[model samples]
Target chain A: MPKIVDHEERRKIIAKATWNVIAREGLGGASVRSIAKEANLSLGAVRHYFQTQEELLEFAMQLVQEQVTERIMEHIQSHLPPKDQVLNILMELIPPEEKKIEMQVWLEYISYKIRKKELQKESVHEVIVEILHRLQKAGLLKEDILLEEEIVLLHALIDGIALHILMGLVPIERGRIRYLLEKELNRIFVE
Target chain B: MPKIVDHEERRKIIAKATWNVIAREGLGGASVRSIAKEANLSLGAVRHYFQTQEELLEFAMQLVQEQVTERIMEHIQSHLPPKDQVLNILMELIPPEEKKIEMQVWLEYISYKIRKKELQKESVHEVIVEILHRLQKAGLLKEDILLEEEIVLLHALIDGIALHILMGLVPIERGRIRYLLEKELNRIFVE
Candidate 1:
């Protein structure tokens, strides 16, 4: 009997390889052939899994979104208090030492989508908005806080810090990121 | 007598053309040929002005930084009060409708630099830090405000909002941006 190849597993393997290529060479250099080589697969194999470059890149982006959501879900299910739990989720969005590759891939994807003028709705922003709403309903946010404006500020601050960290434009250590984030959270969250 | 071609003017024109190409095709697609074509100049003329792509891009980035610095200086010199002066300078960093192309080119340069591991010191961050320190020295900031932390937060928030607006990930309008920024300023600045 012929050997059975797991198509789903193969697709995921290809997507992860695509991420690596983007992290190293940027989205512009992520050609189908290059991705296949990085994945240690033949050109035909990659093509069989993804017909076009756009299709492959789209799948890669989807995989990244799903993985990030999974991580966030794990944090939500943990036993930490809501405040620390929220802080942890925000930290997850900003890449630390190990998560660097993943976030770098994400940044490239964002840049590509922006240039193409086909930017999809950023799910990260929605997650933040939803979390803030949840906290407000639980009476954890300060009474004087304008919910809508706070949402906008917090979202922007998180993304801006992430970009700065990624670029190494500012010398932001992990402790500093935590401190800055915790301070902002304290400003809006009820003590 | 031979026609006198102003060397400085020609170089500036080439740099502007480089910015236009970067804004439209991204840094990856910015080539000497493309930039020359965009400038409606001959290839030899572009080569005469900038020897290599790196030199051309470097000159282009310098022009952007200088232009931004010049605008900030103008804000500093204006008759607006300290608070309004700071707000106006911050607004200049975030691309208004007319400043979109310049910021687009800047974003592309940033993305490219990050990939190449060549990110230089971002002058904008320094300017923010300096301005905050000056305000605190003038006793304009709240007594309880942590100067260092506030600086980091403000820098991140501004850049983050700029990124979101550029990407259209959030429907942030000019008024909303001003409101969000002013509110943050209110939080830190003494009434």
Candidate 2:
């Protein structure tokens, strides 16, 4: 009998391998063969699940969004205070100490979107606006801050911090990202 | 009779072509042939000016820095109020009504640096710090904002706005960018 392969587990392994490849060599350097090699699997096995490189890349990008959403959902379900939950969601984008690879891989995917000229992915924008709206409902947003502008500013702030940290332009410590997120949110929200 | 090409004028033409190509097709698509076509020049004519793609790209990036420097120097020579001069320098990076191509190309170059793992560009950071220090000397920076953190934050804010504007993540109008820059400067500077 042929060895049994856990399909779901295999997809997880491939997704992780894709992240490693992107983090190390960038999106351009990733290929089915490279991902397979990174995952220690045969190319055929990797391709059996994903028909094309674009498909695999889409999967990887979705995984990045999913991971971020899952983490944020965990915080939301914990019923943290509105400000704390909002800050937690924003801070999650700035990967933790051990999760730098995820941020690198996410950036690679973001770059890929530009390279491919596929800028239609608005899920992140929607998720951010949703959280900000929740904060507004909770009376956390400052009355003077326009809701739409605040949402855009929050998204831009989070993206800027994530990019700068990934590029190593700033030598900020891990927890400092959270602190900055808290500080910026505090500046925008009701005292 | 053979055509006479002014070498300096020819370089300027090629640089503009390079910017157009990058803004339209991104860096990966900006090959010599494409740039030559965009410039309405023979490939040989373009190659005579720049020996390699890397050289052309380097020239394009250096031109970005030089243009910003020239504009800022003009302001520095104006002997305006320090806060006004600082805002002028910061706003230069955002481009005017005419030089939007330059900002797009600059962002492309910045992205190239990250993808190539050559993230050693520090001129932009230095320029921001230099201006902010001028503000601080003029007794302009907000009393509570940490100087070092302010530098990094300003850098991130400017970069994030440029990236967003270029990527169409925000439909921020050109004048509105100046307004936003001024508002951000006011927030950082004295009341």
Q: So what's the TM-score on candidate 1?
A: 0.89
Tens digit of per-residue lDDT, candidate 2, span B19-114: 878766666567889988999999998888676656777877777778789988998999888767777777777665477677766656655566
Candidate 1 docking category? medium
Leading candidate by TM-score: 1
Report, for every candidate in turn, its global Cα lDDT versus the true structure. 0.82, 0.73
Q: Write the per-residue lDDT of candidate 2 for residues A89-128, one digit (tens) a residue.
A: 7777767657767766665555556545677755566788
List candidate 1 stretches off by more than 4 Å: A6-9, A137-144, A170-172, B136-145, B170-172
- DockQ (CA atoms), all models: 0.59, 0.41
True lDDT of residue B189, candidate 1: 93
Best by lDDT: 1
- Spell out the clash pairs found in candidate 2: B140-B190
Deviation in Å, model 2, residue B62 alpha carbon: 2.1
